[model samples]
Target chain A: MKSTLIIVALLLMLGGCKSTGGPTLYQQLDGKAGIERLIDSFINQIARDEKIIHYFEDANITHFRDGFINHLCALTDGPCEYIGDDMVAIHTGMNINETDFNHVVELLINAMNELNINHTVQNKVLAKMAPLRAEIIEI
Target chain B: MSMLKFFLGFIACLLPFSNFAGQGKLLATPGVSQVEGSAGGGLVPWAQLAGYATDDEFAINGFCSRADVSDYTLDVCGAQINLFNRVEFSYAEQHFDVPALNTKIEQSITGAKIRLYGDIVYSQWPQLSLGVQHKSLRDGAVATLVGAEKTSGTDIYLAASKLHLGALAGYNWFWNMTTRYSEANQLGLLGYGGANSRQKLLFEGSTAIFLSRDIAVGIEYRQKSNNLGLGEEDWRDVFVAWMPNKYVSVTAAWLDLGSIAGADDQTGWYLSVTGYW
Candidate 1:
């Protein structure tokens, strides 16, 4: 009976490790708290990218942070609606470059990692925000 | 014919990269390699005078200019552009003089920047690119290599960039190092290939700091090895750029370039303009 119980436990662990792809991503990151936690971590990292922190000198520190969260929440099919400045208007004079943009993207991915979000879930989120490049960078 | 075909094949590989990597924002600069930054929706460098990459991968940009050197003599300028992203293709030429000196020279540079990794428009951060530049002067004696003659010099660099804030704000940053050799021992005749093709490595960087609806400021720094096969030199600059709307952009800057070759350091102001449609 002991061996039988051990075998059952092993099988359950194996099942848990299986790749359920999309369903697993949804299960891991679908909730509101999960989304909020992810956004919180992302902003914290951006604040720390010392090389670029100076650009935000004029940004409404707290407001920008919450605005980004709301912007993201609405993007991932969440209930929040983004009520921030239009992309072009907000970034009018900022001379953004690829390195800055990619670095921020990396911080975001790291944020997801801290939240224990899976790769598939992360990719899904990136895909939704990828098109925003047009609005974010000044060409 | 074989060489031509080989060259064509080489060019085909570098196309679409311009589609995703072009700075659509920045313009050509005399300083460090430009970082990967976005120009909102276009594929152009922010500070460069011409676009390295267009919406398509394959593209060519050319320009000619004439500057008054102080008297009856006029200087003619020419630069070539060819690109596709992964691999780079470029040509630059210059021939100007102080007619009173009865002397003139010319130079040219050919180089490439490769695409390594990262998202083209991920938004959260800038685009990333790593590549090498092999620039050199053409076949000309020191006294005759006037204006914009080709240079026989090479440099390597790493670049990362992005676009931000839409029309309200944006910035592009990059770092690079260049090596210059003295020709026949003349310091002013250094940029183009000089004396047995000396090799000097430099550290350079530039940033286009934007603020407001259509105004921007830029800062640049370039450090170089001053060896006719010898040592090093240093230089730095500050600039202000204007983009009244989205179609036209202009930049004027002040420079501090201790010296080059045997020529006295030509530190002064520079102006550049661009119209995008």
Candidate 2:
């Protein structure tokens, strides 16, 4: 096809971008199971402490958990729609202070350690979530 | 004993999901490189610079070392571990709410980008990627949002970056030009029957620079369309990152300045840490 040549020509012009050290070092991990297990690990880390989980007293654990997972999956361009609650609605009245939100974030790091996930994927997810800090913390 | 069992069992169950987005993945993004800092992107480039797909890697590996007028914020959290591979995907959610006024708002970002070969600096013949950061807004408190409530919109962008071998040479950059192609949900749009949404388009750009192998820096300037009525919006930051080891990275940044809704003009800080399996 003419388009194929254009594509090949473009690749030649741009150097056809290839890896230097070895074959691709990464692959798309399994979707659902991988994401849910991560959520559990993350939530459990936050739940162990009374400070952060305390805010969830009036909140439903399942609802909150599902929301967290869906939101994360959607953010990563996964094929899912986050449906539990609106971003602001869930955080409303919960009064998630910067400290609380941040502590949980710490727990999240620990969870990753326990899971032994690679460092690169970890940063990819965190980068996706960083921009939301302003709205979630209100501070 | 049951508690201990539960804890152990939990980790066991999660072990299989090892490769998902965990601490290690977060460690790579430039800004917020650490888990306990206040700076958003002091030493890294913004996530937007990654060109939508969260896993795009240009040919450069260095820390960003820049300061935002508000706080030194690094943006590049990281490049994908998959090499300069093919693929792209991204999504975002924006929220607007005024508790006192009992109003609410929301927005979504859907992005996808693919790499273009050859380096920005051409040393390693870095990869280049083109993507879009679409913004979809829905709200009910537009008038009270402290600024214009451009309901829904999306932006297209082109990004090119490179990675150098050592301490002295490297640079990364990303630019986004989004058009306001949807409704400007006024946050109070309680279904005003049939109000037509306006057509307002805007252009914005962001860039990141590297100063050393483990340290990097950058800044972003976004020119808002005249539609928002806020004239122009600015977000500038500089950050420093410490990659003691590839397994972990710590970053701190100072971000100063403003946005559409407005910041206190106060300096802000961010700390981040990322690691992997």
Q: Interface RMSD, all models, one decimal each?
A: 18.9, 13.6
Off by over 4 Å in 2: A1-139, B1-84, B94-106, B119-126, B138-140, B143-150, B163-212, B246-250, B259-267, B271-277
| TM-scores, one per candidate | 0.46, 0.39
Q: What is the per-residue lDDT of model 2 for residues A3-69, given as tens digits with 9 covering 90 to 100?
A: 3235334534433343344322222224767778888998788778876777777777897778877
Best by lDDT: 1
Candidate 2, residue A102: the lDDT equals 48
TM-score of 1: 0.46
Report the number of the highest-TM-score candidate.
1
Candidate 2 local lDDT, residue A47 = 76
- Candidate 1 ranges beyond 4 A from true positions: A1-139, B1-60, B63-88, B96-100, B119-126, B130-139, B143-151, B162-188, B191-199, B229-232, B244-248, B261-265, B275-277
Candidate 2: give its CA RMSD in angstroms: 21.0
**How displaced is residue A90 in candidate 2, in Å?**
60
